[model samples]
Target: MKNRSVLVSGASIAGPTLAYWLSRYGFDVTVVERAPALRPGGQAVDFKGAVHRTVLERMGVYDEICRRSTGATDMVLVDAHGNERARISGDFTGGDVEILRGDLAAILYEAGAGHCAYRFGDSISTLRETEGGIEVEFENGPAGNFDLVFGADGIHSRVRRLAFGPDEHFVRHRGYYYAIAGEPPHREQSDGPRRRESYAHNDAGRLAVGSGAKAQQMYLFAAPEMHFTDEAEKRRVLTEKFTGMGWQVPEMLAELPVLDDFYLDALARVRMPSYVAGRVALVGDSAYGNTLAGFGTGLAVVGAYVLAGELAASEGEHIVAFARYDRIMRRYAKVGLGSSPGPFLAPKTTYGLWLRDRFLGSRWFGLMEKFAGDAKDDLDLSGYPAWEAR
Candidate 1:
């Protein structure tokens, strides 16, 4: 892969992770992000299953993740009345380990700190695959030629839009509209819905709190089966949905007027027939993303592995590596994002959510625990050619 240049879109999880591995495997890598810089904390992401661990270990960040992880011990299911229904320990949750999404992104960025070219505050405006190589022009004004390009630019990827026609063709609506913003307050806001007294293993269990940070904090809001085309539409729908939902919601909505980092969108997934399209390939959420599936992290880590390993195995030949990258990554993404167990976790309908809480939480709790205990067993990370480059 010497002298072969690659431009990965979005410096989020997958792009940085892939950049480190590709750089290690002898590919010149550059990651571009629309964000001005590595975004600060907003949401918490979990890492479950053995593959997550394997990838982190390989990247040499597993210990760091555990070190900086939010040890959320117990999860209490409460109703609109704040009445507790059931309690689920973090262990019973396969991906129980949770961390601020920004922290994880920071760890990934650190991995390629020096080796990879990081161009922040910009993104790919256009990508053209020519006879000799792919000619790429960036919004930040960088022009270059790359043997191949990968899009890890999250759910709404420009590369995917440009490479694979309009997003409507590949985006499968998952029948839900999710949104998260911080709760506005005076000062000293409590952590929203704490799993226990302390975030650590508190079996005795106490009520969770709100964000105990400074007031005017970011909060989260989600509505189901809403309509929206873009960011403004999403905000309007959110405003319409929670106009009367009480419990400081009005205050949260009031903050919405000034909220800049509002993550509002219909819960959706990309159901591409295949990830590979010409010399451009899609990775992470751009390829397979089922927000309801709860495998965004898994799909991302696995995709990085496939992309790097395939490139190394194929030497510098973009064709062979690109093809094999598609072969391995598509299957992993399918299993991780299209699995059955996920919708049960974040069901869209009342009935489906009831099934999860009642059947899984009540009478079948023991069975569910057993399955969760063995959740990592289904992962088959075999046949991946380990590349120790000469």
Candidate 2:
């Protein structure tokens, strides 16, 4: 058994998943989360290629994930008065099984809890590199030393700031920003499941899609680098941008204050020179967060698997493990992030939006899908011992 200790920051999707694999490899893993408990209310995230499914299958949670999947594979684009403009099917949208992000996180946490130590409502305050390990100071807990530390915290990673530098140096904003929140669909039926309508305002460039009991309200717009310090200011901007819009926009705004999972961020990608430094390394979004490209979740899981496998293969030598992890994921991440459709999703001009809608409504979209093929990720999972054993 590998006796080295590992500290992973952020108990979200990546951190918990990484902890799971590391624990399986006999590493003493600890996951620290800033939130008090497991957070809920994120849209469905799915697996695409064989590589992603292989990792999930190895984790032994694939069946459970499929069972809990939202099964919302098709979406229709509608105008202000709830009329369908264009329809996108399962092939273009959902890859295979699509489960809610929160549900997936819960599954990973449950699987890892027995083997990995969990610290909630706490965060790393400071990190100092020692001769043999990294010394960490917690915001709410006592200081400790771990053989290695990882920053699996999302794009706005605190560990990145402490170890690397500010986020501005790494994140590249792709000319737009988006906000999403789960809210009750308008005009519900109590007899059975609500017959929800996925509406999109072509002129407004906003969308409202069905997601369980509450639907997800999507607000996307093109902007040139603006800053809002607090949530109040962010909400104010959202209100200003979407006040007089149509198709449930008014209702979603009304429910925004009460919604627990209101998340907003720039539709950006992280571009780091390197993902490691000494005993500290980064996984998932901290290293490669291609927001709105629909590949973040899969990348997180695969990255976690590779990081743990490399550690186990290297026998707790972080220097070798980190280098191999970087070498394997760097090109994969580059290709993935390069293919992000952020700019195409939310075009700047009204003409661009009209063009986008026209394509969606036309045969071009279908033709593109036919050529898309099932082969996206190309990572060789067999090389890793963890995956091979499974």
Candidate 3:
């Protein structure tokens, strides 16, 4: 067995999933998160295509994910007056299965936590690389050195900044900002088989999406990125943006302050010349995140699978593994990273909204279905051995 120690930043989907595979391959894995605990914010994330399903099955969490599936087969797009203008079916969004982002993280953490080390409420402060390994210091914990360190940390990755440069150099705003927070289910507003409804104020450039029990409200708006560090300030911005909007906007905003898992961020993508520097590497959102602009949940999971598999295949040689991961994910990630959902989800102009609704109301839905399935299968996972069997 290739015994090496690896430190992964971020406790969300990619970090834990990578930890699971690395541990299975006989590598010592430690995951560090800034949050005090597993963050249960964000909206539902879907898994599509054969590769995504195969990876989950290999990890032995496929069944559990299905059990927790949102089971939402349809989403109704409503106007200010609550008139259904368009419908997006489960066949369009969920692919095979869709689960809340937090739920998926919990499952991945459960699968890997037994074999890996998890440090919550802490973050890497500095990472200095040497010939032997990368020395890491945490914000609230002791320092340590590992054979490798991965920045699975999301778009605003500290590791990426420490290893590469500032986030501005890598993360580009795509003219949209989004927020997700839990709210008590408004069972009365449900318009589908599942208690779910998606409201869009076309003229206001606002979109609200939610599903299932103890639902999450996802709010997106077309805007230039604004800086707001305080939670109250952020909430103020959100309220102002969606103020006077119809179809549950007021209710969703009211739930923001009390929502324990409120998450807010600009919709953007991380672009890098390479995903590695010396012994340090990056995965998931830190490397190829298109934020909500793309099907990043599946992409993040697949990236972790490929990254760990490559490391094992190379017997812990980072140069070989990193290069292979980049090459494999480069082409596959373009369909997402290059395409922005800002225009489609929150169009800036009335004409843009009309055009978007036109497509959704037409045969474009079938094309979207085809695109979802085809995009999921774009990468080849055939050569890598099953992670658990390693």
Candidate 4:
């Protein structure tokens, strides 16, 4: 087997997925995650574009995701009193398949573990770039040398800071904050609430409920317009904002006090002008986390595909592979991010929300259909030059 030792940071969607492709290409791969184990039931994330779907198919886990998808049929724009002014369909709002982040993580972990070496409850402490490669210090295991190290870690990547610099130099907060925790839907849900009536359940402690789709799992959170100077401050702010919102919001907040990953700062997009430096390269949210526009998940997978393919095509020449990967991947990323997930996440103002609600009533729903088709074509992987694995 051709084994060019590679050390990857982060074990989320990107890192493990990258490990899958690299191992397929006969590379010695090791992944490190800060979390002790795979986190369960995080916010629901989805795959819309074709490239993402392609990656899942390639990994042989797409079918599993389809089975686990929270097929929430509808959503209501609700008021405190539970009055629904507008509603959106799940297939229309999410993608062809939408699964909880934890479920997706589980699928990836199952596919990747045997093929790649994984180190949990640890991270890279320091990195020194050199002529042959970079010297890395681990927070847990013994330090070692590798031909290449990747920062597939999420938006708040330690590899990015160690290799590049502080996050302030890269992340762009899109003017919002959010927090979430798993809970039981107060009103009980089969497909989602048929009608919109929102209120606090005294014992159930659910807000505006209908299990996401299955009614088996639920979550609640509050997002306000605020700028978090750093990740630490972001969690603190969430703690403050959600400490007492009543209903299920308070419960989610209460849970936040104990867990580590429960409270995520508002949506922030990682914007790096370039993703490569010498022998090292960054992928996933570490490089261009267009969380604001296309919801980083698909973009990360597409990037992983292109990166591993380019590396294999170039026979592990770092510079050539990274440049080609960036050239092809960035354009698609720009197109999708430019499409704007911001509006869907949090409208800028009341007027903007009103406009969105107005559009929901229009037969222009076909616009979304056309948009989805165009997006699928845009994510087409056949356009990429495939590499013959050694």
Best by lDDT: 3
Pick by lDDT: 2 or 3, better one: 3
lDDT of 3 by residue, 196-259 (tens): 4454445547777654334667788888879987988888888898888776667766766776
Q: Is candidate 1 or candidate 3 better by lDDT?
A: 3
Most TM-score-accurate candidate: 3
lDDT of 3 at 235: 80
Off by over 4 Å in 3: 1-3, 184-196, 209-215, 251-259, 386-388
User: In candidate 2, residue 236 scores what lDDT?
Assistant: 82
Q: Rank the candidates by lDDT, best first.
A: 3, 2, 4, 1
- Per-residue lDDT of 373 in model 1: 34
Cα lDDT listed for each candidate: 0.67, 0.78, 0.81, 0.68
Write down the RMSD of all candidates, one decimal each.
5.7, 3.4, 3.2, 5.4
Error at 359, model 2, angstroms: 2.6
User: What's the number of clashes in each of the models?
Assistant: 20, 0, 0, 2
Question: Model 2, 10: alpha-carbon shift in Å?
Answer: 1.4
RMSD of 4: 5.4
* Worst 10-residue lDDT window, candidate 2: 187-196
- Tell me the tens digit of each residue's lDDT in model 1 across 130-194: 88778999887668888778899988789999889888898866654556555322211244323
Instruction: Give the C-alpha miss distance for residue 48 in model 3, angstroms.
Output: 0.7
